[model samples]
Target: MDHKKVMIFLLSSMLFISSSGSITAGESSEKIKAKLENIDYGDITLKDSAKVKPSFNLQEVSSNETKQNFYDERIPKVNLESGAVISQKNKQIEIPFTQPLDSTDEALYSHDLVIKQLGLANTPTLIPVMEYTTRVEGNQIIITFLVDYTDEYSVQVKDPYFIRSNGNLATPSDVYITTKNAPVNVDSPKVSLESGTVIPQINKEIEIPFTQPLDSTNEALYAHDLVIKQLGLTNTPTLIPMMDYTTRVEGNKIIVTFLVNYTDVFSVQVKDPHFIRSNGNLASPSEVYITTSNTPVTIESPKVSLESGTRITQSNKEIEIPFKQPLDSTDEALYAHDLVIKQLGLINTPTLIPMVEYTTRVEGNKIIVTFLVDYTDEYAVQVRDALFIRSNGIPAIQSEFYTTTKNDQLIVD
Candidate 1:
């Protein structure tokens, strides 16, 4: 055999034996100890000599490995109702959760897997607390949750929403009234005159001024009638004659006037002015007089009689009597006496009584006549003439008288 071939074979055999021994040694306690020494349990303060209990049991270790797989399978199966899938291929799918992933272990693993596959955090994740149920129907997911997390989180991020509608805010229009111009000041006196008096008829047109500028078209602003309200006078609402005026504008004022009638003076009594006496006598004229300061005033009788008769005295005034004759009576003489008293303006009418007795005797061709009167009362009697003689031959007359009663009730001749 050649020495070079022998050297190659021996080197190959040695290399094979060394490799087998290394494999067996790697599976031994020495390798296990080395691995355990290099691991840090995090914040364990035990000294090198201290006896530390192993936190990991072989059974638990095995179960933990199984639980890791269990968590991965169960978490995805949770359906994360409030989330959606961004990408998927074959049996694997990438879902975009509504919120950040929360589980510590799962989040780390999912992050690594997602970064490796998607090359970014684009595989959206959610907190374990946010996982909910969703029903997939066609391209849409009917998501439902025990708690609504979207709205709860949005309140912290955005403003509230509102709606707009018609007739929300409005304003109204304005209305007003206007008037015309008229004369402000004018003086007019109301006068009453007697009938049959001739008066001056002035037809001159006067212009009345108004206080404020007025629209003449507005009749309400114009004077419909001359309203003369008597302030100091006792009577009210005196009606004055209506006069039309021509309107003229001088600066800002108006002036108005009317032509009044004038008449001549005449004298007449305003009242009956006289009275009648009870016994057909007249009172003194001074008792029935009246005078006025105004001239051209008409005086008319009241057309009625007072209790006294008319009697004019030296005082230049008519006086009243106690009685007057009745105007309406069935007695002709009484009515005639009344007419006479009225014509004379006497206060009363005289009362007439019948002549009671007449005495006649013939004495030597001469006739002597005696007259007597009877009054109802003794005080009413008055003897004027007792006797009168008529001579037949010469047509001569004679008279004589004698009184007997205290009231002169008897007469003799």
Candidate 2:
């Protein structure tokens, strides 16, 4: 009887545990099915009876459902200090702040900055900080942002201006920085070379054109500020002997003249910011091409002739020669080396006339050569090869010839 009772009690305990498990599982399954009904499983459609199979495990259905967007509220936020504004000068604006930025701030090249014309309907210009630099002085960080524009501006800085040490995006204080109005007349000086200028190989001079007249006192500083270079040459060109080159200002132009030793294609460039205009604007350096050839352009061979008479006038010590081009008048020393005077018709040896002093002046195509002869000779005189004419410092070409022959005679009286 005791064995029978023990078996019946064990059977009763097992029946109660099985029923409790079934009730809990049924409740869990009902909850899971209710949650799945609200979820749109993409393209698949199902009804209440098809909610779940009777033998399906509730854990499998709960594990397979996907969560599309889950937000975690633990991300760090941006921090923008107060009192940040902008200052203006011409087209450039400066962002000023009372509190120094972090040493590792990305403000230099940050793309989150926006500048806009406040009054206009124009779209805000997204100006990435293209040019900027940062320096640390004591506990402060100094940064300069270089921005250019044509009108007034209002600056805007978005969130996450910099990344914090804790991996949080820190933004500058949200503020509208209104810049002052830009100046209208303050423009950079402009320079250009006149076209159709024929550069000579020997004596080269050009008048540089300017948008504004240069300061007279500062014009003298540009005597050496202009640099001359040969274009196609591999090596530096040998500049002609450095004479007293004249640099002067006439109206809105600067005239520069220098001696060139060799002839080839050349270029002229302004050296630095030393060139200044009357309006206090510095001249922007520029380069211009100058084509050069070895052939002389403005010079024609000088024509040498003698006054006709059986007896040459001895009293007239001057010999006059006419040229097809005007002579260079600025040449201070126009003497015997330029005009070689040699007497002809010598039996033993030709007697070259010693030129003591000479004067040359160009009147249109005529060059009056006034020769003050020291010694008197009765031989026929003639001029030598081409003379360097001085209207614009161009050398005149000439065919060499001694005017007087062996039979030719002259009375030096």
Candidate 3:
């Protein structure tokens, strides 16, 4: 009976030990399953036995999203000691400070902070800052300042400023006043034509227009001082008034017309050589024939011959004849007789007697007639006697020859 009781106690003790082992094994299995489900493969933990708790917040689950939000929030709140605010409201921001940050701020900073926040890489080196009282009106913001700083600052800032650091701020530029002195003692302007330059005859009237208008108050400014220089000419400049000029503008070009008064300085010279001839004495009619070496000439009623060879008549009526022949005594006598008869008709015939003598000679390609006549009737009568001969063998007598006698009238050949 004792042996039976010992068996029952041993069996009960073995059953209890078996149940405790199963319970411990089941608890370990549950803990292992929970750790396996919660463990982050991305994170490295030094303690293998340590348990990892599951994060309940949806945002905490995404490491990338958490980092992005942190950066976005941190960038906008950045402020500089220079009173510059780096915020999302101002699309453009400029920073001027250049210094290392102290340990008081534990935030992570980067040079690309503005770039990353704004999603813009190429920002202006220096950006102007404007601050004024702003009022919200509907969808727009109306900003006003009692004493605006931007205008004053712009006057002071001559060149663009370069940004040196992030979150740095600068005061607005200062106001400046610049004064310049007016030009002094400006002489009147002048227009000059180039030397040896020939302008079109039709374009004698020219008007020159200025790129910029002259002062209306100063009349001298409107006056044009012009100088014209030509080849083989004196260097005297001509002056004219600009107000009298006319102008027209075609695109960017100016057409100027000047009322120019031009004068020719050189005088033309004319010359000719001529000869006067008679039969014997200067009292008789003479003939004149002109020879010109240069320009052509016109004679006004040029009396080639005259009964009184002492004088020649040149009047309003003119006659033109080219120089071709050598004038001599015979030609002179014939010309004089013909002129008297033709002009005064046969009724006005004054017994014509040659009073001049001409000695004709030929020199090279030219013919010359020398005058040798004096105003004397005796010399004319002597010439007439020498030229005339008795008709039909009758002895020629001066008185009977010229007078009408008996039944015979005086005749001359």
Candidate 2: regions farther than 4 A off: 1-33, 36-190, 198-206, 213-225, 229-251, 255-267, 271-413
Best by lDDT: 2
In model 2, the clashing pairs are 80-173, 301-397, 327-390, 327-391, 328-389, 328-390, 328-391, 329-390
RMSD list, candidates in order: 48.1, 21.4, 38.5
TM-score of each: 0.14, 0.26, 0.14
lDDT to native, each model: 0.23, 0.45, 0.25
Pick by TM-score: which candidate is best? Answer: 2
Model 2, 134-219: lDDT tens digits are 44332233334465443344455456445232333334546544334422234556675544344544355656777777656556
TM-score-best of 1 and 2: 2
Ranking of all predicted structures according to TM-score, beginning with the best and ending with the worst: 2, 3, 1
Alpha-carbon deviation at 109 in model 3, angstroms: 37
Candidate 3 Cα lDDT to native = 0.25
Q: Is candidate 1 or 3 superior in lDDT?
A: 3
lDDT of 1 by residue, 1-413 (tens): 34333333433333222222221122444444444444444443325223333332334436777878754433321223322112222212333322233332332222122111110113233332244333333222222333422111100101211110121111111111000112211222111233322222123322322223322221221222223221111232332333422223332222222333212111211121111111111111111111112222223311212212222221111112111121111121111111111111234423333222323333333222222433222111121211111111011111111111223322332
| TM-score, structure 1 vs. true | 0.14
